[model samples]
Target: MSNESSPLQSSLLVSERMAFKLHRQGMIMETIGKNNAVCNEYPSPILPKERWRYQMVNMYPDSGQCHPFGRR
Candidate 1:
């Protein structure tokens, strides 16, 4: 049999990419926050279309403004 993985079985799924992007952003924010002191509470891996996370709860200003998660 041929060796191949289905779309669902792929490691780099859409959700995985989304999470990775979020994590990367968070790490950047944490670094900037430490430097500028404007950022507190490193943002957790964010999800798409999550209005609740839009709030600055323990997060820096305008965090994840690039996309509100649900945006295409």
Candidate 2:
């Protein structure tokens, strides 16, 4: 046994640093819906692409622009 961290540990540290950097650069982990609210409390678990799709489909119907979920 040696008193040194493994390569995997170092890699994990670097990854965490990069994630923080990206987040600080105004890059949200997920997208907000039409209501201008995030679905989940934590944006990390939410997917941006899926949220965008849902917003578009819900905001605009096939015929024209309408509120599918009902006006708030």
Summarize candidate 2's per-residue lDDT along 1-72 as a digit string, tens digits.
143277534544454455555656645554445567645433453222322211234433555442222121
State TM-scores per candidate.
Answer: 0.27, 0.37
Which sections of candidate 1 miss by over 4 Å? 1-4, 27-41, 44-72
Q: Worst lDDT window (10 residues) for model 1?
A: 47-56
**lDDT on C-alpha atoms for all candidate structures:** 0.45, 0.41
Q: What's the C-alpha lDDT at position 55 in model 1?
A: 29
Error of 1 at 67 (Å): 26
- Model 1 / residue 20 / CA error / Å: 0.8
Root-mean-square deviation of Cα positions for candidate 1 versus the true structure, in angstroms: 12.5
lDDT of 1 by residue, 14-69 (tens): 54465667776775233237567575676655433344222224546665553333
TM-score of candidate 1 relative to the true fold: 0.27
